[model samples]
Target: METTIYHYALCVSLTLMLFFSYRFFFGRLPDSELYRPYRQSRRLMGVALLELSANYMVHFFITPRAVCPTIAILMNLCTYWLSVWLFGSAMMLLLDREWVSRRRFVRHIVGWVAYCLITLVLWFLLPSRVSLTALPIVLAIVFMAYAVRVARKVFLTFRRTIRRLDDYYSDDGAAYIRWMSVFTYWAVFFGAGQGVFTFVPDRYVFVWIISAIPFYTYLYESYSNYLLLYEKATDILDKSNDADAADEEQQTAQNPSQSVADNVNCELNARPQLVMSHDQEVALERGIKEWIDKEGYTVGGLNIADVARATTTNRTYLSAYINTHYQMTFREWVNMLRLDYAKRLMRDNPELPVAEVARQAGYLSLSYFTKTFKDAEGVTPGKWCR
Candidate 1:
């Protein structure tokens, strides 16, 4: 009866988390921001669902079983994967920041290495026996150590970022870091308290009940973050609408010369040049062409955030803009540009090797470029070059 209740609670918490995760990446995106995090989030969601399913099955139905090796292995794999996901998220957040530096990257690498080492040790130490008793003991110690390290780094980074924030910002969601910290603590606690039932079973049940509280809290916090982001989007749209109206009125009242300026601004603010209402993707394509021809910029070794910064925008905003304008995500947009450039360059330089052409056309990964080009152009770079 008690185990069933715990399973129910876990399921509810995971379900809520999944819902909010979807809402965060999909539901709230404007046309401009649709492709970036949304694309990545979709991939992450698959991983997350697998992880959650494995975790639940092992913890509920097969906690002491040796028969279900599949679920057991999945649980072990997912434990590592969860940490990787968290680390990746933190890296993405930091990479998105304007102030990301070499030192920060170094620290991030160090933190990731430490996490990997700890996870490997834990995996080795994990008992071959299927009882919850030995497993939790190992999990608790390992999680506590890893959680402590992560907590220190995350809190320090969060504090630094918060201090750099403006005194009054329309959008402030730094509070999520606090909730994440609490969740980390709870994860460690739950794993640590797994064996306490031997001494006092009822007390252990209460500990589980306490642990469920934080899981619920974490899930709710995720939902709240998504809600806040959605609200912020609505506010921006409202403000933009008001500004558009005010501009129209001023344009109506203006003389001919001033009206020309208004017209230019209007064109700039018009629906992004695409089939859809507005698209960031089209704008990115146009921007890439302009940079190559006019400014001599290169996309080699470039990530999405780098492209965003080059365009004087945030990645989310730029991603939405590209999606709205060109109907493609940053990844698609970048590959398209690279492949296009490679084709033109290869045609112009017939003597050049396909790999050289790819490199010259700003592709960091030759194999990746070849694969993407084949998908897009229906021919391999080498074959095309030939």
Candidate 2:
């Protein structure tokens, strides 16, 4: 009895902490499309939290193992399913594109929640033998089917979103997407823990609730950090979809001569796929090389737009030119340039602080620099310098 009381107390405390932390930190973000989804996310999360608190409170009144074992297990299982369903639905809205209406999408989510609630309530009110035997079978079928669908959606959507973020920007967009990926896997792990509660002894419930604190705290942190840059992410999503092929026409590039007779050897098959002239390519190649020679990649927060301005071209041309000539995305090209430069800087100025080395190498985040360096060279920057 005391263990159960303690478990609910911890749950309420954890939920309140997660609930208030986001509001305190990101409460002032002005309303926008991305924020609307995040707000909807928060709303559904609030409902889940309320359900958790209430369900835990109910455990104080009746022990599932002792009396009406079927209804009790039904109650516990329903609470777990509601939490997962609500949270999954929240993530769906949070990752939405502007191509759809948020208001309508949210209505659909809430309606789904209502449907799940009704189904679970019906199961709870069923006879004991049926609830015991049928619930597990039904849940197993539903879980298997739902898991497959979720795997496909996450793979496709995340691949597109991450690809678009990579193709468009050289910032935290993919980082945000990667964190969401982690949270999704974490949700799977969290949901799986419920199986233990459904089948095992009750004392282990405390262990699962303890795990919930950090797992959902990460969820809250990622959502808040995402809101910090959700506009950039949403901009990329709004402009493209997974099914759409990239347009070859240069929308942002300055008007350049279309004469293809100049004969520049970029050697990319995708070269002919674009509208760029040979002369324009020649000028861009020369200008981009000069920019690199001048250490333009060393600029803090360097992005494709900055490179576009420096080369007197535009983003579309710069991106395509890099993709064609270098055979890497702009971010990869810049990172390679910066990493090579940082190694040279380390060789020449071994006394430089690792942080200074990272700063001079165009990495705004030292941790990001260290990780990238280690991933590339098999050693930390400092260790590599030594």
Candidate 3:
């Protein structure tokens, strides 16, 4: 009875903490075509859900003998580490294209193999030697510190990228931001899991209770990700369906089998023109294109001030012009220019390699170019070029 009560209270507390964590630090989804990545990333959410559900089954349904709880704990720890490493690899591959560079990818794979070998050796050598000792506690602290470092870097990088997008790109930026948060939460929660066991000492039940925090965290986040993804997808589907219905209505008004694109154009013609400014903004747009097309200056070296100087405008005005005229932030506008140029190069000069085209198009790094291109074009540079 006492054990049951203790477990119940622990579960309650853990649930409350998770609820607040999400409330305070959760990410929002975007409301536009940019949410396509978020829709695609539902695969990750599905995998995570499966893993979390499996964990619960192991803990609750398969109650092993208490005679070897220590061994069971060690096995659990090793398996958890393996799972974390795998999940981290997936995130690095999906979130950051550069992570899969030839050298880094090989190194990561080798490192995982080594970790597995070491884990196997340790299991045979000291299978049940794990204890609530000073060493474990110290290691836990180190792991937590590593987690903090990783989390800081991930959060800052994500924030900077998102901030570079203007209002038009905010939806896509929001989706990436959500993904970053999900990955960051995974890192911090698991890293902190080691610390929980350290402090809980010989109280096996308490160790399990503390460990449940990360489990719950993963479960809730994965569930939320799936829900948001489905919601966004459904919203898009409904809008597309409404557009089809309107097109059908127009077709009926005219001749049967009239095209939807024609009806869309008809409807679009009725919309009011967006007001334009006759200021430094229009000049800046012309300057950016002229400089890129004529001078062949690479985008990596170009900044707001540089473009402003080329257009004989101030940085503030150039930035505002990009936002107002192009419906893009400075970074988005630049990327759009580069992507457009890349597409042209690809289509015109099919003989050139994608990387060479990227270079010629003013992209600094082919990896970054590929990622940005895929983000914009919905396909790899090679595929799109083909």
Candidate 4:
């Protein structure tokens, strides 16, 4: 009787937590303008909750001894399939949308289906619970393999994306990456815990309770970090729009005669010109350099969007201006400025430590700083200082 009560209590608590997790995360996103990925996450969560409820109902309400085993096997397989799909979807959404190809997804589905079919076939053929334990152990091994692959892909995607963005070293970006790392590690930990519980069911209860804490904790943290990144992107768009409006107003007010010429040029170049006007490009370049010097933005985490906001220009214009005038990506351009700043600092304060120079120069990683400095200067910071 106590065992039955404990089982039902655990099921009820998990179900309630799932309900709140869904409500807290998905409820706040507006239905009218819901992002497709977020909607998919909500649906996955719903399916997961339904699978849990179905499993609970099968265990609690069904009393027929002859059919209970069969039903249990079916429910467990369904639950496992849903869980795998949910995990795959989460990996694709959180890491990189383009990472998972259609062929890969179809292959995953087929593999999982085969696993489920084989487990069902073996369950009735082999009457021993000890024999059935092998199925879960095999499944756990498969899950761990998949988790490792996803983690590797996520790390590569993160590094590549950071290199493309201007504010890669900013506090928010660092926090976002940290949360993602936590999420990936927790996922691996959960897989290992599941494997342990499968092999040794005696401590299943304790493991389940303990695992739930970190599972939800990291899951929430990952989602929160994703939302923070989304908010930052939205702010950049808003600022860009404001800046464009302000520029147009000022241009119209200051040069009424030139406004007609500007309008004609805009109309002529409405098809998106590869090259910007020489005069306009030069002015933007000068303004950006002056702003960077005045604000000391060479310290890491300085993005083109931040510079655009300060210079009252949009990202489109700033990117084009930099590419045309500087012949480098935003990342390269910023690193060049930072390296120059570091060199100046080293020359002036010969006693300053190399690590301190890297920190002051806006480098988040000492190794990365050392590598970049050596690549640009053809010598280590220490050697350069000497």
What overall lDDT goes with each candidate model? 0.49, 0.65, 0.52, 0.59
Q: What is the C-alpha lDDT profile of model 1 across 1-386, one tens digit per residue?
A: 25566567656655654564555445544455433443443344444444554555555555522344333433443354354444334333431332335675467557656755664565567665633345444544554465455455555555543322211111222332344455445543443233232124421443443454555446446535644454443343334345435544544564446556556754664322212123544666666566547423244645444454466543434544656557765556556666677778888888988778767777655776677788887989778777
Task: Please report how far candidate 1 places residue 111 from its true position, in Å.
Answer: 10
Report the lDDT of model 1 for residue 6.
57
Model 2 TM-score is 0.70
lDDT of 2 by residue, 127-184 (tens): 8677777775565445435544554465556765666556555544577567767877
What lDDT tens digits, residue by residue, belong to model 4 across residues 245-362? 6655665686666556656766664312334577867778788878877845555656566777788665556765666568876667777877888899998999999999888888
Model 1 residue 196 distance off true place after TM-score fit, in angstroms: 8.7
- Candidate 2: worst-modelled 10 consecutive residues by lDDT: 261-270
Error of 4 at 53 (Å): 4.9
lDDT of 3 at 29: 51
**Worst 10 contiguous positions by lDDT, candidate 4:** 166-175
Q: Candidate 1 versus the native: TM-score?
A: 0.38
| Best by the TM-score measure | 2
Off by over 4 Å in 4: 1-5, 21-26, 31-34, 52-78, 98-105, 126-136, 166-172, 203-206, 221-229, 233-301, 304-386
Clashes of each: 17, 0, 0, 1
